[model samples]
Target: MTTTLQINGRPVAVTAEDDTPLLWVLRGELRMNGTKFGCGKALCGACTVMLDGEAVRSCATPLAAVQGRAVSTIEGVKGPEIDALRRAWTELDVVQCGYCQSGQLMSACALLRHTPKPSDADIDAAMSGNICRCGTYPRIRAAIHLAAGDDRR
Candidate 1:
Protein backbone atom coordinates (compact mmCIF):
# COMPACT_ATOMS: atom_id res chain seq x y z
CA MET A 1 0.00 0.00 0.00
CA THR A 2 1.00 3.61 -0.48
CA THR A 3 0.59 6.22 2.22
CA THR A 4 1.25 9.90 2.04
CA LEU A 5 2.22 11.86 5.09
CA GLN A 6 3.74 15.21 5.74
CA ILE A 7 7.34 14.76 6.82
CA ASN A 8 8.98 17.79 8.33
CA GLY A 9 6.95 20.18 6.14
CA ARG A 10 6.87 18.28 2.89
CA PRO A 11 4.38 15.71 1.71
CA VAL A 12 5.76 12.45 0.39
CA ALA A 13 4.23 9.13 -0.57
CA VAL A 14 5.75 5.86 0.53
CA THR A 15 4.86 2.41 -0.68
CA ALA A 16 4.93 -0.22 2.01
CA GLU A 17 2.71 -2.63 3.81
CA ASP A 18 -0.04 -0.98 5.77
CA ASP A 19 1.31 -2.44 8.98
CA THR A 20 4.91 -1.58 8.25
CA PRO A 21 6.32 0.31 11.17
CA LEU A 22 6.97 3.94 10.42
CA LEU A 23 10.51 3.56 11.71
CA TRP A 24 11.49 1.10 8.98
CA VAL A 25 9.93 3.22 6.27
CA LEU A 26 11.75 6.25 7.62
CA ARG A 27 15.17 4.63 7.92
CA GLY A 28 14.82 2.18 5.07
CA GLU A 29 12.48 3.23 2.29
CA LEU A 30 12.61 6.98 2.80
CA ARG A 31 16.31 7.12 3.50
CA MET A 32 15.50 9.34 6.44
CA ASN A 33 17.91 7.86 8.92
CA GLY A 34 17.62 10.43 11.62
CA THR A 35 15.05 8.30 13.39
CA LYS A 36 16.95 5.34 14.80
CA PHE A 37 15.89 1.83 15.72
CA GLY A 38 16.88 0.92 19.25
CA CYS A 39 14.21 -1.62 20.03
CA GLY A 40 11.47 -3.11 17.92
CA LYS A 41 9.24 -2.69 20.89
CA ALA A 42 8.03 0.76 21.91
CA LEU A 43 9.75 0.56 25.25
CA CYS A 44 12.70 2.58 23.98
CA GLY A 45 12.09 6.13 22.93
CA ALA A 46 14.97 5.92 20.46
CA CYS A 47 12.41 5.88 17.66
CA THR A 48 10.37 8.79 18.89
CA VAL A 49 8.88 11.14 16.31
CA MET A 50 6.33 13.89 16.41
CA LEU A 51 2.95 12.90 15.15
CA ASP A 52 0.97 16.10 14.73
CA GLY A 53 3.05 17.85 17.37
CA GLU A 54 2.78 14.92 19.78
CA ALA A 55 5.67 12.54 20.21
CA VAL A 56 5.00 8.90 19.28
CA ARG A 57 7.14 5.82 19.09
CA SER A 58 7.87 5.38 15.43
CA CYS A 59 9.07 1.84 16.03
CA ALA A 60 5.54 0.79 16.85
CA THR A 61 3.62 3.30 14.74
CA PRO A 62 2.32 1.89 11.49
CA LEU A 63 2.56 3.78 8.24
CA ALA A 64 -1.18 3.60 7.82
CA ALA A 65 -1.66 5.31 11.16
CA VAL A 66 0.26 8.34 10.00
CA GLN A 67 -1.49 8.86 6.71
CA GLY A 68 -2.46 12.50 6.29
CA ARG A 69 -0.82 13.28 9.61
CA ALA A 70 2.27 15.38 10.08
CA VAL A 71 5.34 13.44 11.22
CA SER A 72 8.39 15.36 12.40
CA THR A 73 11.63 13.50 12.86
CA ILE A 74 14.74 14.99 14.38
CA GLU A 75 16.00 15.86 10.92
CA GLY A 76 12.85 17.80 10.07
CA VAL A 77 11.66 19.23 13.39
CA LYS A 78 12.15 22.99 13.42
CA GLY A 79 10.86 26.12 15.12
CA PRO A 80 11.89 28.29 18.02
CA GLU A 81 11.40 25.49 20.55
CA ILE A 82 13.68 23.06 18.75
CA ASP A 83 16.24 25.77 18.12
CA ALA A 84 16.38 26.56 21.81
CA LEU A 85 16.71 22.85 22.57
CA ARG A 86 19.60 22.51 20.14
CA ARG A 87 21.40 25.38 21.78
CA ALA A 88 20.73 24.09 25.27
CA TRP A 89 21.84 20.56 24.37
CA THR A 90 25.11 21.93 23.06
CA GLU A 91 25.68 24.32 25.92
CA LEU A 92 24.83 21.72 28.54
CA ASP A 93 26.63 18.88 26.73
CA VAL A 94 23.60 16.64 26.91
CA VAL A 95 24.72 14.00 24.41
CA GLN A 96 26.73 11.05 25.70
CA CYS A 97 26.47 8.02 23.41
CA GLY A 98 24.58 10.24 20.96
CA TYR A 99 22.43 7.28 19.84
CA CYS A 100 19.48 8.37 21.92
CA GLN A 101 19.92 12.11 21.51
CA SER A 102 17.53 12.37 18.56
CA GLY A 103 14.70 10.78 20.49
CA GLN A 104 15.62 12.76 23.58
CA LEU A 105 15.56 15.97 21.57
CA MET A 106 12.23 15.12 19.96
CA SER A 107 10.60 14.46 23.31
CA ALA A 108 12.11 17.63 24.76
CA CYS A 109 10.81 19.67 21.81
CA ALA A 110 7.28 18.46 22.48
CA LEU A 111 7.55 19.31 26.16
CA LEU A 112 8.77 22.81 25.44
CA ARG A 113 6.01 23.33 22.93
CA HIS A 114 3.32 22.46 25.47
CA THR A 115 5.05 23.78 28.58
CA PRO A 116 7.54 26.48 27.84
CA LYS A 117 8.59 26.87 31.44
CA PRO A 118 8.64 23.36 32.80
CA SER A 119 9.80 22.65 36.32
CA ASP A 120 12.21 19.85 37.16
CA ALA A 121 9.34 17.56 37.98
CA ASP A 122 7.70 18.38 34.67
CA ILE A 123 10.93 17.65 32.85
CA ASP A 124 11.26 14.37 34.68
CA ALA A 125 7.74 13.35 33.75
CA ALA A 126 8.09 14.38 30.14
CA MET A 127 11.44 12.68 29.69
CA SER A 128 10.93 9.64 31.84
CA GLY A 129 10.18 7.44 28.87
CA ASN A 130 13.38 8.25 27.05
CA ILE A 131 16.24 6.19 28.43
CA CYS A 132 19.86 7.12 27.83
CA ARG A 133 22.28 4.28 28.40
CA CYS A 134 25.00 6.82 29.12
CA GLY A 135 23.08 7.98 32.21
CA THR A 136 22.90 11.57 30.98
CA TYR A 137 19.59 12.16 32.69
CA PRO A 138 21.00 15.03 34.75
CA ARG A 139 22.34 16.81 31.72
CA ILE A 140 19.13 16.13 29.81
CA ARG A 141 17.04 17.68 32.55
CA ALA A 142 19.35 20.64 32.76
CA ALA A 143 19.20 21.09 29.01
CA ILE A 144 15.42 21.07 29.08
CA HIS A 145 15.47 23.64 31.85
CA LEU A 146 17.90 25.76 29.89
CA ALA A 147 15.83 25.44 26.73
CA ALA A 148 12.69 26.42 28.60
CA GLY A 149 14.47 29.48 29.94
CA ASP A 150 14.26 28.10 33.47
CA ASP A 151 17.93 28.00 34.32
CA ARG A 152 17.59 27.44 38.05
CA ARG A 153 20.30 24.83 37.84
Candidate 2:
Protein backbone atom coordinates (compact mmCIF):
# COMPACT_ATOMS: atom_id res chain seq x y z
CA MET A 1 0.00 0.00 0.00
CA THR A 2 1.08 3.53 -0.69
CA THR A 3 0.36 5.96 2.09
CA THR A 4 0.86 9.65 2.60
CA LEU A 5 1.77 10.97 6.02
CA GLN A 6 2.31 14.36 7.52
CA ILE A 7 5.64 13.93 9.20
CA ASN A 8 7.44 16.72 10.98
CA GLY A 9 5.21 19.33 9.41
CA ARG A 10 5.96 17.89 5.99
CA PRO A 11 3.92 15.55 3.86
CA VAL A 12 5.60 12.24 3.03
CA ALA A 13 4.46 9.43 0.80
CA VAL A 14 5.57 5.82 1.22
CA THR A 15 4.69 2.64 -0.63
CA ALA A 16 5.00 -0.56 1.37
CA GLU A 17 3.10 -3.38 3.03
CA ASP A 18 0.23 -2.35 5.25
CA ASP A 19 1.72 -3.96 8.32
CA THR A 20 5.23 -2.60 7.88
CA PRO A 21 6.53 -1.00 11.05
CA LEU A 22 6.88 2.77 10.93
CA LEU A 23 10.55 2.40 11.83
CA TRP A 24 11.41 0.66 8.57
CA VAL A 25 9.53 3.15 6.45
CA LEU A 26 11.25 6.03 8.16
CA ARG A 27 14.76 4.53 8.13
CA GLY A 28 14.66 2.39 5.05
CA GLU A 29 12.30 4.03 2.59
CA LEU A 30 12.26 7.58 3.91
CA ARG A 31 15.90 7.49 4.95
CA MET A 32 15.19 8.85 8.39
CA ASN A 33 17.63 6.89 10.54
CA GLY A 34 17.35 8.94 13.68
CA THR A 35 14.88 6.45 15.13
CA LYS A 36 16.74 3.27 16.09
CA PHE A 37 15.69 -0.36 16.12
CA GLY A 38 16.68 -1.76 19.49
CA CYS A 39 14.68 -4.72 20.71
CA GLY A 40 12.05 -4.40 17.93
CA LYS A 41 9.65 -5.06 20.77
CA ALA A 42 7.81 -2.22 22.46
CA LEU A 43 9.70 -3.14 25.66
CA CYS A 44 12.67 -1.09 24.54
CA GLY A 45 12.08 2.51 23.53
CA ALA A 46 15.08 2.69 21.23
CA CYS A 47 12.77 3.33 18.29
CA THR A 48 10.83 6.18 19.82
CA VAL A 49 9.49 8.96 17.64
CA MET A 50 6.87 11.62 18.01
CA LEU A 51 3.57 10.71 16.44
CA ASP A 52 1.51 13.88 16.27
CA GLY A 53 3.94 15.38 18.76
CA GLU A 54 3.57 12.53 21.26
CA ALA A 55 6.32 10.05 22.01
CA VAL A 56 5.61 6.62 20.50
CA ARG A 57 7.55 3.44 19.81
CA SER A 58 7.83 3.49 16.04
CA CYS A 59 9.24 -0.01 15.92
CA ALA A 60 5.90 -1.48 16.86
CA THR A 61 3.68 1.19 15.34
CA PRO A 62 2.15 0.14 12.05
CA LEU A 63 2.59 2.54 9.15
CA ALA A 64 -1.13 2.43 8.40
CA ALA A 65 -1.95 3.70 11.87
CA VAL A 66 0.15 6.81 11.31
CA GLN A 67 -0.63 7.39 7.66
CA GLY A 68 -2.64 10.53 8.14
CA ARG A 69 -0.93 11.56 11.36
CA ALA A 70 2.21 13.57 11.80
CA VAL A 71 5.37 11.70 12.76
CA SER A 72 8.40 13.45 14.21
CA THR A 73 11.67 11.58 14.29
CA ILE A 74 14.82 12.61 16.11
CA GLU A 75 16.00 14.28 12.92
CA GLY A 76 12.86 16.37 12.90
CA VAL A 77 13.42 17.68 16.45
CA LYS A 78 13.89 21.41 16.34
CA GLY A 79 12.86 24.72 17.90
CA PRO A 80 13.60 25.98 21.41
CA GLU A 81 12.65 22.88 23.38
CA ILE A 82 14.81 20.56 21.32
CA ASP A 83 17.70 23.00 21.13
CA ALA A 84 17.69 23.52 24.88
CA LEU A 85 17.50 19.78 25.53
CA ARG A 86 20.32 19.06 23.09
CA ARG A 87 22.55 21.62 24.71
CA ALA A 88 21.84 20.22 28.13
CA TRP A 89 22.50 16.71 26.89
CA THR A 90 25.90 17.74 25.63
CA GLU A 91 26.81 19.92 28.60
CA LEU A 92 25.82 17.25 31.10
CA ASP A 93 27.38 14.43 29.11
CA VAL A 94 24.08 12.61 29.36
CA VAL A 95 25.04 10.05 26.71
CA GLN A 96 27.29 7.12 27.50
CA CYS A 97 27.05 4.62 24.62
CA GLY A 98 24.80 6.87 22.49
CA TYR A 99 22.75 4.12 20.87
CA CYS A 100 19.79 4.93 23.09
CA GLN A 101 20.24 8.66 23.36
CA SER A 102 17.93 9.37 20.42
CA GLY A 103 15.04 7.60 22.10
CA GLN A 104 15.97 9.09 25.46
CA LEU A 105 15.93 12.56 23.96
CA MET A 106 12.63 11.93 22.22
CA SER A 107 11.00 10.90 25.51
CA ALA A 108 12.54 13.84 27.32
CA CYS A 109 11.31 16.17 24.60
CA ALA A 110 7.77 14.85 25.00
CA LEU A 111 7.89 15.13 28.77
CA LEU A 112 9.11 18.71 28.66
CA ARG A 113 6.56 19.61 25.99
CA HIS A 114 3.70 18.47 28.21
CA THR A 115 5.14 19.45 31.56
CA PRO A 116 7.18 22.56 31.25
CA LYS A 117 8.06 22.18 34.89
CA PRO A 118 8.48 18.57 35.98
CA SER A 119 9.58 17.08 39.28
CA ASP A 120 12.20 14.39 39.60
CA ALA A 121 9.46 11.80 39.84
CA ASP A 122 7.80 13.13 36.72
CA ILE A 123 11.09 12.85 34.92
CA ASP A 124 11.55 9.38 36.28
CA ALA A 125 8.08 8.30 35.25
CA ALA A 126 8.37 9.68 31.75
CA MET A 127 11.88 8.40 31.22
CA SER A 128 11.50 5.01 32.85
CA GLY A 129 10.83 3.35 29.53
CA ASN A 130 13.95 4.68 27.85
CA ILE A 131 16.98 2.84 29.18
CA CYS A 132 20.56 4.04 28.93
CA ARG A 133 22.90 1.13 29.51
CA CYS A 134 25.81 3.39 30.48
CA GLY A 135 23.88 4.44 33.56
CA THR A 136 23.56 8.17 32.88
CA TYR A 137 20.35 8.46 34.88
CA PRO A 138 21.62 11.13 37.22
CA ARG A 139 22.96 13.26 34.41
CA ILE A 140 19.86 12.77 32.28
CA ARG A 141 17.63 13.87 35.16
CA ALA A 142 19.77 16.89 35.83
CA ALA A 143 19.81 17.88 32.17
CA ILE A 144 16.06 17.55 31.84
CA HIS A 145 15.61 19.86 34.78
CA LEU A 146 18.12 22.31 33.42
CA ALA A 147 16.45 22.36 29.99
CA ALA A 148 12.99 22.64 31.50
CA GLY A 149 14.07 25.80 33.24
CA ASP A 150 14.86 27.31 29.87
CA ASP A 151 11.41 26.37 28.64
CA ARG A 152 9.95 28.34 25.81
CA ARG A 153 6.68 27.60 27.61
Candidate 3:
Protein backbone atom coordinates (compact mmCIF):
# COMPACT_ATOMS: atom_id res chain seq x y z
CA MET A 1 0.00 0.00 0.00
CA THR A 2 1.01 3.58 -0.41
CA THR A 3 1.54 5.85 2.55
CA THR A 4 2.20 9.56 2.96
CA LEU A 5 4.01 11.05 5.91
CA GLN A 6 5.68 14.34 6.65
CA ILE A 7 9.32 13.95 7.53
CA ASN A 8 12.16 16.30 8.15
CA GLY A 9 10.04 19.27 7.17
CA ARG A 10 9.28 17.61 3.85
CA PRO A 11 6.44 15.45 2.58
CA VAL A 12 7.46 11.97 1.46
CA ALA A 13 5.34 9.43 -0.37
CA VAL A 14 6.18 5.82 0.37
CA THR A 15 4.91 2.53 -0.96
CA ALA A 16 5.02 -0.03 1.79
CA GLU A 17 2.74 -2.20 3.83
CA ASP A 18 1.00 -0.46 6.68
CA ASP A 19 2.79 -2.66 9.14
CA THR A 20 6.21 -1.71 7.79
CA PRO A 21 8.15 0.00 10.50
CA LEU A 22 8.87 3.66 9.95
CA LEU A 23 12.52 2.90 10.47
CA TRP A 24 12.64 0.81 7.29
CA VAL A 25 10.93 3.42 5.18
CA LEU A 26 13.26 5.99 6.65
CA ARG A 27 16.53 4.15 6.12
CA GLY A 28 15.60 1.82 3.29
CA GLU A 29 13.16 3.73 1.16
CA LEU A 30 13.79 7.34 2.00
CA ARG A 31 17.55 6.85 2.31
CA MET A 32 17.73 8.76 5.56
CA ASN A 33 20.15 6.67 7.57
CA GLY A 34 20.60 8.88 10.59
CA THR A 35 18.12 6.79 12.55
CA LYS A 36 19.93 3.60 13.40
CA PHE A 37 18.53 0.12 14.03
CA GLY A 38 19.67 -1.30 17.32
CA CYS A 39 17.19 -3.65 19.00
CA GLY A 40 14.36 -3.11 16.49
CA LYS A 41 12.25 -2.74 19.61
CA ALA A 42 11.07 0.32 21.48
CA LEU A 43 13.36 -0.56 24.34
CA CYS A 44 16.28 1.09 22.54
CA GLY A 45 16.00 4.72 21.65
CA ALA A 46 18.43 4.41 18.74
CA CYS A 47 15.51 4.81 16.40
CA THR A 48 14.05 7.78 18.22
CA VAL A 49 12.48 10.47 16.04
CA MET A 50 10.28 13.40 16.76
CA LEU A 51 6.64 12.82 15.99
CA ASP A 52 4.77 16.08 16.20
CA GLY A 53 7.72 17.48 18.16
CA GLU A 54 7.75 14.61 20.74
CA ALA A 55 10.34 11.88 20.57
CA VAL A 56 8.99 8.47 19.44
CA ARG A 57 10.82 5.26 18.75
CA SER A 58 10.55 4.80 15.01
CA CYS A 59 11.59 1.19 15.20
CA ALA A 60 8.31 0.16 16.79
CA THR A 61 6.12 2.84 15.30
CA PRO A 62 4.42 1.50 12.15
CA LEU A 63 4.28 3.70 9.10
CA ALA A 64 0.49 3.72 9.04
CA ALA A 65 0.39 5.08 12.54
CA VAL A 66 2.48 8.06 11.45
CA GLN A 67 0.62 8.86 8.26
CA GLY A 68 0.05 12.59 7.92
CA ARG A 69 2.11 13.32 11.00
CA ALA A 70 5.24 15.43 11.11
CA VAL A 71 8.31 13.31 11.85
CA SER A 72 11.54 15.07 12.65
CA THR A 73 14.76 13.11 12.63
CA ILE A 74 18.10 14.28 13.96
CA GLU A 75 18.72 15.61 10.49
CA GLY A 76 15.87 18.06 10.86
CA VAL A 77 16.66 19.70 14.20
CA LYS A 78 17.58 23.18 13.09
CA GLY A 79 18.19 26.64 14.50
CA PRO A 80 19.03 27.55 18.09
CA GLU A 81 18.12 24.56 20.25
CA ILE A 82 19.95 21.97 18.20
CA ASP A 83 22.86 24.31 17.67
CA ALA A 84 23.28 24.66 21.41
CA LEU A 85 22.89 20.93 21.98
CA ARG A 86 25.34 19.98 19.27
CA ARG A 87 27.86 22.46 20.57
CA ALA A 88 27.34 21.22 24.11
CA TRP A 89 27.71 17.62 23.01
CA THR A 90 31.07 18.52 21.55
CA GLU A 91 32.08 20.77 24.44
CA LEU A 92 31.09 18.16 27.00
CA ASP A 93 32.53 15.31 24.90
CA VAL A 94 29.30 13.39 25.14
CA VAL A 95 29.88 10.91 22.31
CA GLN A 96 31.85 7.74 22.74
CA CYS A 97 31.32 5.26 19.90
CA GLY A 98 28.88 7.79 18.43
CA TYR A 99 26.11 5.29 17.86
CA CYS A 100 23.72 6.41 20.56
CA GLN A 101 24.53 10.10 20.55
CA SER A 102 21.93 10.95 17.93
CA GLY A 103 19.10 9.64 20.02
CA GLN A 104 20.54 11.24 23.11
CA LEU A 105 20.80 14.62 21.44
CA MET A 106 17.30 14.33 20.04
CA SER A 107 15.83 13.70 23.48
CA ALA A 108 17.98 16.40 25.01
CA CYS A 109 16.98 18.91 22.36
CA ALA A 110 13.33 18.22 23.06
CA LEU A 111 13.83 18.66 26.76
CA LEU A 112 15.74 21.91 26.40
CA ARG A 113 13.27 23.20 23.86
CA HIS A 114 10.37 22.77 26.23
CA THR A 115 11.88 23.07 29.67
CA PRO A 116 14.73 25.45 28.74
CA LYS A 117 16.05 25.29 32.30
CA PRO A 118 15.28 21.76 33.42
CA SER A 119 16.58 20.70 36.82
CA ASP A 120 18.67 17.61 37.45
CA ALA A 121 15.60 15.47 38.17
CA ASP A 122 13.87 16.79 35.08
CA ILE A 123 16.90 15.97 32.96
CA ASP A 124 17.02 12.47 34.43
CA ALA A 125 13.35 11.85 33.74
CA ALA A 126 13.54 13.16 30.19
CA MET A 127 16.60 11.10 29.32
CA SER A 128 15.82 7.95 31.28
CA GLY A 129 14.35 6.08 28.31
CA ASN A 130 17.45 6.46 26.15
CA ILE A 131 20.27 4.09 27.05
CA CYS A 132 23.88 4.66 26.15
CA ARG A 133 26.07 1.59 26.30
CA CYS A 134 29.12 3.82 26.71
CA GLY A 135 27.79 4.98 30.11
CA THR A 136 27.87 8.63 29.10
CA TYR A 137 25.28 9.64 31.68
CA PRO A 138 27.47 12.16 33.43
CA ARG A 139 28.49 13.80 30.19
CA ILE A 140 24.92 13.72 28.97
CA ARG A 141 23.73 15.58 32.05
CA ALA A 142 26.56 18.06 31.72
CA ALA A 143 25.83 18.57 28.05
CA ILE A 144 22.15 19.21 28.79
CA HIS A 145 23.13 21.90 31.23
CA LEU A 146 25.60 23.39 28.82
CA ALA A 147 23.07 23.40 26.00
CA ALA A 148 20.44 25.00 28.18
CA GLY A 149 23.01 27.78 28.63
CA ASP A 150 22.69 27.05 32.32
CA ASP A 151 26.32 26.16 32.73
CA ARG A 152 28.51 29.08 33.86
CA ARG A 153 25.72 31.45 32.94
Candidate 4:
Protein backbone atom coordinates (compact mmCIF):
# COMPACT_ATOMS: atom_id res chain seq x y z
CA MET A 1 0.00 0.00 0.00
CA THR A 2 1.00 3.59 -0.55
CA THR A 3 1.10 5.64 2.62
CA THR A 4 1.69 9.35 2.84
CA LEU A 5 2.53 10.86 6.19
CA GLN A 6 3.25 14.34 7.38
CA ILE A 7 6.69 13.96 8.84
CA ASN A 8 8.49 16.93 10.29
CA GLY A 9 6.10 19.26 8.48
CA ARG A 10 6.78 17.62 5.13
CA PRO A 11 4.67 15.07 3.32
CA VAL A 12 6.46 11.80 2.62
CA ALA A 13 5.18 8.86 0.64
CA VAL A 14 6.19 5.24 0.99
CA THR A 15 4.91 1.93 -0.30
CA ALA A 16 4.63 -0.86 2.19
CA GLU A 17 2.20 -3.27 3.75
CA ASP A 18 -0.14 -1.84 6.34
CA ASP A 19 1.44 -3.97 9.04
CA THR A 20 4.97 -2.81 8.24
CA PRO A 21 6.44 -1.15 11.26
CA LEU A 22 6.90 2.61 11.05
CA LEU A 23 10.53 2.16 12.08
CA TRP A 24 11.39 0.25 8.90
CA VAL A 25 9.50 2.75 6.80
CA LEU A 26 11.42 5.62 8.34
CA ARG A 27 14.80 3.88 8.23
CA GLY A 28 14.57 1.66 5.15
CA GLU A 29 12.03 3.21 2.78
CA LEU A 30 12.40 6.85 3.72
CA ARG A 31 16.06 6.60 4.69
CA MET A 32 15.57 8.60 7.88
CA ASN A 33 17.87 6.82 10.33
CA GLY A 34 17.76 9.06 13.37
CA THR A 35 15.15 6.84 15.01
CA LYS A 36 16.90 3.72 16.28
CA PHE A 37 15.66 0.17 16.78
CA GLY A 38 16.49 -1.29 20.16
CA CYS A 39 13.67 -3.68 20.88
CA GLY A 40 11.03 -4.28 18.21
CA LYS A 41 8.48 -4.98 20.93
CA ALA A 42 7.98 -1.32 21.83
CA LEU A 43 9.13 -2.00 25.36
CA CYS A 44 12.23 0.01 24.63
CA GLY A 45 11.77 3.64 23.71
CA ALA A 46 14.71 3.51 21.29
CA CYS A 47 12.22 3.80 18.48
CA THR A 48 10.25 6.62 20.03
CA VAL A 49 8.91 9.35 17.76
CA MET A 50 6.31 12.04 18.20
CA LEU A 51 3.02 11.14 16.66
CA ASP A 52 0.78 14.20 16.66
CA GLY A 53 2.96 15.70 19.36
CA GLU A 54 2.94 12.60 21.62
CA ALA A 55 5.80 10.13 21.73
CA VAL A 56 5.07 6.71 20.25
CA ARG A 57 7.30 3.72 19.75
CA SER A 58 7.82 3.50 16.02
CA CYS A 59 9.12 -0.03 16.13
CA ALA A 60 5.69 -1.23 17.15
CA THR A 61 3.64 1.44 15.38
CA PRO A 62 2.40 0.50 11.94
CA LEU A 63 2.92 2.68 8.89
CA ALA A 64 -0.81 2.67 8.21
CA ALA A 65 -1.43 4.14 11.64
CA VAL A 66 0.67 7.17 10.78
CA GLN A 67 -0.92 7.98 7.46
CA GLY A 68 -2.04 11.59 7.34
CA ARG A 69 -0.73 12.07 10.88
CA ALA A 70 2.22 14.15 11.91
CA VAL A 71 5.21 11.99 12.80
CA SER A 72 8.26 13.76 14.17
CA THR A 73 11.52 11.88 14.52
CA ILE A 74 14.71 13.13 16.08
CA GLU A 75 15.58 14.67 12.73
CA GLY A 76 12.24 16.44 12.73
CA VAL A 77 12.18 17.67 16.35
CA LYS A 78 12.54 21.44 16.45
CA GLY A 79 11.54 24.66 18.24
CA PRO A 80 12.70 26.45 21.40
CA GLU A 81 12.22 23.54 23.78
CA ILE A 82 14.18 21.30 21.47
CA ASP A 83 16.94 23.87 21.24
CA ALA A 84 17.13 24.18 25.01
CA LEU A 85 17.07 20.42 25.43
CA ARG A 86 19.85 19.97 22.92
CA ARG A 87 21.96 22.57 24.66
CA ALA A 88 21.34 21.00 28.05
CA TRP A 89 22.14 17.57 26.67
CA THR A 90 25.42 18.88 25.30
CA GLU A 91 26.43 21.05 28.23
CA LEU A 92 25.48 18.41 30.80
CA ASP A 93 27.01 15.51 28.83
CA VAL A 94 23.82 13.47 28.66
CA VAL A 95 24.98 10.97 26.06
CA GLN A 96 27.20 7.98 26.73
CA CYS A 97 27.51 5.44 23.91
CA GLY A 98 24.82 7.47 22.08
CA TYR A 99 22.62 4.57 21.02
CA CYS A 100 19.56 5.62 23.03
CA GLN A 101 20.09 9.38 22.98
CA SER A 102 17.82 9.93 20.02
CA GLY A 103 14.90 8.24 21.73
CA GLN A 104 15.74 9.97 24.97
CA LEU A 105 15.74 13.32 23.23
CA MET A 106 12.47 12.59 21.49
CA SER A 107 10.83 11.60 24.78
CA ALA A 108 12.29 14.62 26.51
CA CYS A 109 11.02 16.91 23.79
CA ALA A 110 7.53 15.56 24.24
CA LEU A 111 7.80 15.99 27.99
CA LEU A 112 8.96 19.58 27.72
CA ARG A 113 6.33 20.41 25.18
CA HIS A 114 3.61 19.32 27.55
CA THR A 115 5.08 20.15 30.95
CA PRO A 116 7.28 23.17 30.23
CA LYS A 117 8.45 23.13 33.84
CA PRO A 118 8.52 19.57 35.04
CA SER A 119 9.39 18.54 38.55
CA ASP A 120 11.73 15.64 39.21
CA ALA A 121 8.79 13.29 39.55
CA ASP A 122 7.39 14.57 36.28
CA ILE A 123 10.70 14.10 34.54
CA ASP A 124 10.99 10.61 35.95
CA ALA A 125 7.48 9.69 34.84
CA ALA A 126 7.99 11.16 31.39
CA MET A 127 11.32 9.44 30.81
CA SER A 128 10.47 6.15 32.45
CA GLY A 129 9.81 4.50 29.12
CA ASN A 130 13.15 5.35 27.56
CA ILE A 131 15.85 2.92 28.61
CA CYS A 132 19.42 4.20 28.53
CA ARG A 133 21.62 1.14 28.90
CA CYS A 134 24.51 3.48 29.54
CA GLY A 135 22.71 4.27 32.82
CA THR A 136 22.52 8.00 32.19
CA TYR A 137 19.14 8.38 33.90
CA PRO A 138 20.54 10.90 36.35
CA ARG A 139 22.05 12.98 33.56
CA ILE A 140 18.89 12.60 31.50
CA ARG A 141 16.72 13.87 34.33
CA ALA A 142 19.15 16.71 34.93
CA ALA A 143 19.08 17.66 31.26
CA ILE A 144 15.30 17.72 31.26
CA HIS A 145 15.35 19.90 34.34
CA LEU A 146 17.96 22.13 32.76
CA ALA A 147 15.93 22.44 29.58
CA ALA A 148 12.92 23.42 31.67
CA GLY A 149 15.04 26.27 33.03
CA ASP A 150 15.31 24.64 36.44
CA ASP A 151 18.57 25.35 38.25
CA ARG A 152 19.91 21.88 38.96
CA ARG A 153 23.37 22.92 40.08
* Backbone Cα, N, C clashes tallied per candidate: 0, 0, 0, 0
Give the true-structure RMSD of model 3.
1.4
Q: Answer with 1 or 3, whichever has the higher lDDT.
A: 1
Give the TM-score (vs. native) of candidate 4: 0.98
What lDDT tens digits, residue by residue, belong to model 2 across residues 19-136?
9999999999999888999999877789999987789999899988897788888987876778989999898888888999999999999999999889988999999888788888
Which ranking of candidates, highest lDDT first? 4, 1, 2, 3
- In terms of lDDT, the poorest run of 10 residues in model 1 is 144-153
Compared with the true structure, the alpha-carbon lDDT of candidate 3 equals 0.87
lDDT of 3 by residue, 1-153 (tens): 877788888888899999999999999999988988889978878888888878888899998889888899988877688899899889878899989888888888888878999999999998988989999999999888888878842
TM-score per model over all chains: 0.97, 0.94, 0.95, 0.98
- Please report, in order, the local distance difference test score of every candidate based on alpha carbons: 0.91, 0.88, 0.87, 0.92
**How does candidate 1 fare on TM-score?**
0.97
Clashing pairs in 1: none
lDDT of 1 at 10: 98
Candidate RMSDs in Å, in order, are 0.8, 2.6, 1.4, 0.8
**What is candidate 4's lDDT per residue for 1-67, written digit by digit as tens?**
7878899999888899999999999999999999999989998799999999999999999887998
Candidate 4, clashing residue pairs?
none
lDDT at 110, model 3: 81
Checking candidate 3 for backbone clashes, the offending pairs are: none
